[model samples]
Target: MVLGALGVCALVLGWRALDLQVLQHDFLARQGDLRNLRTEPLAAHRGVITDRANRPLAVSTPVTTLWANPREVLAAREQWVKLSNNPVLNSRTLSQRVEANAGREFIYLARHLAPEQAQQVLDLRVPGIYALTEYRRYYPAGEVTSHLVGFTNIDDVGQEGIELSMDNRLRGTPGRKKVVRDLHGRVIQDIAVLEEAHPGSNVTLSIDLRLQYLAYRELLAAVTRNRAAGGSAVVLDARTGEVLAMVNQPAYNPNNRSGVQTAALRNRAITDVFEPGSTIKPLTVAAALESGLVSVNSTVDTRPGTIRVANKTIRDHRNYGVIDITTVLTKSSNVGTTKLALAMEDHALPAFMEHFGLGTATGIPFPGESDGMLPIRSRWRDIETAALSYGYGVSVTALQLARAYAVIANGGIKVPLSLEKVDQPPQGERIISAEHASALVSMLETVISAEGTARRAKVPGYRVAGKTGTVHKLTAAGYADDRYVALFAGIAPAEDPRIVTVVVVDDPQGQDYYGGLVAAPVFGSIMAGVLRTLNIEPEQPVGTYAGVIDREGRL
Candidate 1:
């Protein structure tokens, strides 16, 4: 009888627990009904950019943004009033801030807010205020890859660089949550969902940091030494068209994007145009040789240091009368080169210029790439033809000029330049004969030797072949005084050419305009640094080879 009484007590207790929980469950849930109705954004992370070895170049870090539900604040007006009394609040007049945001369902307090500031706001215990998460892009290389990595706005939207070009791919759709809520202001469960957030894919670049730094330091030193307004450098692998380095002076840090002048942000390599000057002579010579108008040994009469065509007189930079075609390049004899270009058919000259990749965009992956102006044949006056022969009256961007030399370095085949790696470059169409390219290389090599104008560009262990150009800057009115573009385009280890590096120094203020003194030294210095960084063994021992070296097998 006693055991039965204990069992009866246990059953009674169980019944009472069930009565409170199961029988009254609906009533309790009703009290917390709308709690589950809160809507939250599901954001996807942006992709990281890395080098081939997965070394970070661009990265993203999570940052917080503060916002508010105006309706909730309105309901808790007493708490909001207490919040309004804070002195550090942004609004000068709390009444105006409350009024502007009074009727709205949502209002953004601030974005990418500092955590300490956010904590202060949270400590106020304002009813509707909340924080959301977002990603901010950071370029680790700083100004080093600023031109390539670009930047984005606070909204996680791309405004420039790879971010702008790949905005569609880099930016992901944000997901949202919806739910049903009871009158008691508590959500029950999720009701519907769509547009799932997906993270962006990784983007890899062809740029090598080692080679990039090499070019950067060398070019920076050149501009400082020459007292130049600006400088640009490019290194392209001749075999694959892989762009190893794209360096520029006056580079801006992507980290600080405020109040930046447009000029400082410009990519001089692809955007700025200048007269190509004497660097253009090789193309003219190639056309002449290809068309059988001249041979490497053929001579031209460069008499009196000048030649008259129509009303204009073309003058050699300095006279070397009756020089061979090779000697024309060695001495930079403009009169001989012009005479050679004039010998070709007018139509063929333009065709050859087009073949050399002038007056076209190089199709580099960058924003605002200018397709430099190449005047039509109809615009050519007689003087224009002769002047064009020596690189004047025609504006070409640094990219177009570099690609033109790349064609020569690539064994007369024109391969499209790429910022990204290629499994294989499509078989490029032959633009010039191999024989003509070989002849041009021979002439160009002399330019880096003691007999040539660009002797300063010679590398001790390497046989370097290239052209030096010094052109006058054009003013709105016409050509101006004392301003010049000094440029050098060359391939190193000429016996087995690899990277074709081009260096352009704009408007040096110093006493030198000759590319030898201004741009060629920059080229030599950059190439040497690149070789050392890449662990490319020198062709000679320390202080062994001074100039030309016969083609030798590498270790």
Candidate 2:
């Protein structure tokens, strides 16, 4: 009976071996392969961001991330301890992580290390340690282009600015490949790639690095010299409506944002809004001209330099008695603008401003772009209308103000603004009659004359047409008497407009808080550089000002 039982046991064991090896062969083989074979991600390089001239603004650099199988690392004991010697890896933290993830097969040991640095760790020959290739974003222009080009996160995802707006286009798809690993979880054999990685497509922005540098330098100097809170400047190709340069003061370096203030990260030119002050006068005059209620030759009486609207009293710098419409804008007269606004039909002014791109988005591909507030009321109050005329009761960003001037520069056409390079000039909607636009440009030229408010805004060889604005910053207690926003918006080579620029210096301290004193000089300096950089020919002799009134009021 013992012999029979032993023989039966051997038969049963043979049958079980056959069943295991033959019946479940594929399933068992798959389970075994799962332990040794793995699918690894192949990092894709992000696209290059460049200026219109193809200068690199942002690029990606190769990096290495070191990872290890926690179980293997803990098992290696002494071998793992050697890794703690590297400065980037904390000994206690590493030990804690490995111990906590003791059952896991993978954990990051060090991320985004330079290849040379990662090689030093690999040379130690730890059993479970391995390196994976990755890419990190690098800004070539640093803080100069930080506000616009933006920065990305450690995972190569865009976090702000253009990087965030165009993320999907800039971040390419990651590929995958199969690899065989040893028991310690180290890659041992190369396997076939399941997919190939495609690098992201390049982005070409309308920004001119040369002009960007010019704008950045000048804006920084003005902000520092004036001891201002912050500022923004925008330069646009008037004919094409493409942004040549856009910069903000209090900029933060995107490459290294260790302790950057949250406020410094904002692209203020497009994101922040303020009452445009006297900068809106030119638009107000345009509205009046379009309404046929006023003419360039028409005059408004300024008697005692102040006027009453409801419970508010509007005042100019001083009493000039009476002034023409052109003089109204040249002087940035609140009384004159109020007269113009009060004479027009309530809806007329707002409708005209809307046509000029106020209260609307410029359609530029940027994150956090604010469409400035243009109030709509079923019934208009005299005070509201007057305030709207002189650039209150409404708000605008520096970019929107630049675009409004571009309409007059582009001969009444309102072209869509573009952040990217434009191969062709875009079609534009006609906001005003070209005749009226030309007439307005001619009137604005007087503002840069010797006797006008923005005399300092003049470029030596070109006829500049612009307006000056100094607005009391509105606070919770109402308009702050001590704080001001100095602004200058202009078109260069006014006869044949090429570029439109707007400079906004907020809360300028000291006695020089007026737009003509603070912002106009910045406008002149930047416009001069831009005009020369574009190789635009001079329209007149450098020192000559024919047909322009002299400081003595003599033509």
- Please give the CA lDDT of all the candidate structures: 0.77, 0.90
Each candidate: RMSD to true structure?
6.0, 4.9
- What's model 1's TM-score? 0.87
| Best model number under TM-score | 2
In terms of lDDT, the best-performing candidate is 2
**Candidate 1 clashing pairs?**
33-186, 33-187, 34-185, 34-186, 34-187, 35-186, 35-187, 36-187, 37-187
Regions of candidate 2 where Cα sits further than 4 Å from its true position = 1-36, 181-189, 543-555
Which tens-of-lDDT digit does each residue in 1-555 have in candidate 2? 999999999999999899889988899989988888889998899999999999999999999998878877777788767767676664576788789888998898888999998888777777777889999999989999999999999999999999999999999888999999886456888788999989998999999999999999999999999999999999999899999999999999998999999999999999999999899998999999888998778999987999998998899889978889888987788999999999999788888898888998888889999999999989888999999999988899999999999999999999999999999999999998898888889989999887788887878788889999999999999989899999999998888987999999999996699998899989988999999999998888866744553333344
Worst 10 residues of 1 by lDDT: 546-555
**Tens-place lDDT digits, model 1, residues 422-528:** 77775787899877777788889888877787877767666779988988889887887778899998887676666688899988987777787889888878887
